[model samples]
Target: MASKVIHALYNDDDILMLAVKKVKAAKHHIEEVYCPFPVHGLDKAMGLAPTRIAITAFIYGCIGLAVATVMMNFIMIQDWPQDIGGKPSFSYLENMPAFVPIMFELTVFFAAHLMVITFYMRSKLWPFKQAENPDVRTTDDLFLMEIEIHDNEEELLALLADTGAVEINISEK
Candidate 1:
C-alpha cells in the first residue's frame, strides 16, 4: 500500500521553523522533519513529549554503584582480608576510601553505555535497519518537512508556498 505525502524543502532552519508553526496553526498534521543538524526547540514546537532517557541513566548508575559496593565488600572483607601496609583491618567501612574511584568509574560507565544502547533501541536504529531519511540533501544543508496528504493537496500546497518553501514535491510512500 502506498500513501501520498507532501515534501516541502527549505534552505534555512529559521524558515523551516516558521513553516512548521504555520502548518501546525492550520491544523495540518506534520509527519516528520529532517535537518542536517539539531534545531533548538524543534521538539517543543512539534509538541513532542519529553524523553525519559535521564531516568534510565539514573537507574543504571544506581545498579552499577550497588554492584561495585557488593563486589568490593565481598573481595576485601570476606574473601581475602589482606593486612597491607601494616593496616590490619578487615572492615569494609574502613577501606571505603580505596573503593571510591572504582565506584565512581563504574557508575559513569554504566550510565553512559546503557544510555547509548537505550537511545539506539528507542530510535529503531538496529544494525541491519535501513535509513528512513526522505531526502539526501537534508543530511547536508537543506531541511525537509513531510506531511501526509489527506485529500487536501491544493490547500496544503498553497499553504506551503505562503510559508516560503523553496521547493515542494508530492510523492507516494
Candidate 2:
C-alpha cells in the first residue's frame, strides 16, 4: 500500500500547538515534525524523548583527554626522556605545569574532531549523502507536521482545517 502524508505548514508556534492538540483529540497519527528553529517545550508538545547526543559528546571528550594525557606522559617522561634547560627529567610531577598547554590543545583537538566524526557516523551522515527532506521551505521558514492517514482523507482534511493550517499538501511515497 502507498503511504500518504498530510502535511500542514505553520508560521507560528501557537498554531502548531493547536494543530497538535486537535490531532491528538482526533487520534491521528503524526509521522514527523520539522521546524526551522527549536521551539520551547516542543519535544514535550510532541511527546518525544530527549536526545543522547550530549552524553555521547561528553564520553568522546573524556576519551580524548585520557588519550592525550597518557600519550604526553609516556613520550615526555618514559621513553627517550630529554633534559631541557637543566630541567628535571626524572619525573613530571615537579614540572607538570609546563605540559598544561599541550594537554589542553590535545584535549580540544580530540574532542572536536572525534565528536564530529562520531556524530556523523551515528547519524549516518557522510559525504554526498542526500537527505530525504519533504520540503525545502520547512528547513528555513516554516514548521511542518506530517500526518499519516490510512484511508480517511476527508476526515483528516476537516481536522486540519479546524486547526487553522495555513496551507496543506499531500504527498504519496
Candidate 3:
C-alpha cells in the first residue's frame, strides 16, 4: 500500500538538525532523515533508542574465548602434547601464558566479524539491496528529511518552509 509523505530538503546539516527538533517538538513522526555524511547527535534528535550491539559483542567475545580455550587445550594438551621453548605442555593451566595472545586475538576476531553480521541482519541490509532513499541528492551534499503526511498538510508545509528547507515535496510511497 502507498502512503503519503513529505520530503523536506535542507542544504546544511545545522538547518536539518533544527528542523528535526522542531518537527519532533510538534509531535510529528519523522520517517527518516538522510545525510551525505554522519551527523553527530542525530540519533538523539530522532529520539531513537540506544543500540544494544555492545552487549551482543560481549557475548560473541565470550563464545570466541570458549572456542579458543577448547581448541587450544585439545591441540596442545590432548592431541599432541610436547615441550616447546623448554616448557612442557602437560596441561592447559601450565601453558596458559603462551595462549594469551591467541585467546585475545580470536575473541576480537569473532566479536568484530559476528558484530558486523549482526548489524546487517538487524538493519535488513545485504548484497544487491535496492536503495531505500527517496532522494539521490541525499547521497551527495544534501540532507533530506521525510515525514508522514497527516491531515494537517498545510500546517506541515508552513512549518517545513519556516525551518529553512530548500525544497518541500509531497509524495506517496
Candidate 4:
C-alpha cells in the first residue's frame, strides 16, 4: 500500500524549525525530518519522547561491574591463590585495590558498546539496511520535512508554502 506524503524542502535550519513549529501548531502531523547536521531542540518541536538509552547504559555498566568483580574474585581468591608482592590474595577485600582499573575499564567498555548496540536495535537500523530518506539533498545542505497527507492536501501545501519552504513535493510512500 502506497501512502501519500508531502516533502517540504528548506534551505536553512532556522526556517525548518519555524516551519515545524507552525505545522505542529496547526495540528498537522509531521512524519519525519532530515537535516544535513544536527538541529538542536528539533526533537522537542516534533513532540518526540525523551530517549531511555541513558538508563540502559547505566544498567549495562552495573552488569559489567558485577561480572568483573565475580571473575576477579573467583580467579584470584578461590581458583589459585597467589601471594604477589607479599600481599595474600586469599580474600577479595584485601585485593580490591588491584582490581579497580579492570572494573572501571569493563564498566566503561560495556556501557559504550552496549549503548551503541541498543540504539541501533531500537532504531531498527540493521546491517546493510536501506535508508528511508526521501531526498538526497537533505544529506548535503538542505533540510527536508515529511508530512503525511490525510485528505487535506491543498491546506497542507498552502501551509508549507507559507512556512518558507523553498521547494514542496508531493509523492506516495
For each of the candidates, the C-alpha root-mean-square deviation to the true structure, in angstroms, is: 1.2, 2.2, 0.9, 0.8
TM-score of each: 0.95, 0.85, 0.97, 0.98
Query: Any runs in candidate 1 off by more than 4 Å, and if so which?
Result: none
Candidate-wise lDDT, in order: 0.93, 0.82, 0.95, 0.95
**Residue-level lDDT for 113 in candidate 4:** 95
In candidate 4, how many Å is residue 114 off? 0.8
lDDT of 1 by residue, 56-131 (tens): 9999999889989999899888998888877655688898888899999999998999899999999989998888
Task: Report the candidate with higher TM-score, 1 versus 3.
Answer: 3
Flag regions of model 2 displaced more than 4 Å. Answer: none
TM-score-superior candidate, 1 or 4: 4
Number of backbone collisions per candidate: 0, 0, 0, 0
Residue-level error in angstroms, candidate 4, position 35? 0.8
Q: Candidate 1: which pairs clash? A: none
The residue-by-residue lDDT of candidate 4 on 85-135, one tens digit each, is 999986999999999999999999999999999988899999999998899
Off by over 4 Å in 3: none
Tens digit per residue, CA lDDT, model 2, 1-173: 79888988988877898788778778776888888887777676677788887777677778777887788778988886888888887886765888888777877787788778888898799999997778888888888999887889999998898888888999895
Worst 10 residues of 4 by lDDT: 82-91
Q: Give lDDT for model 2.
A: 0.82
Task: Tell me which residue pairs clash in candidate 2.
Answer: none
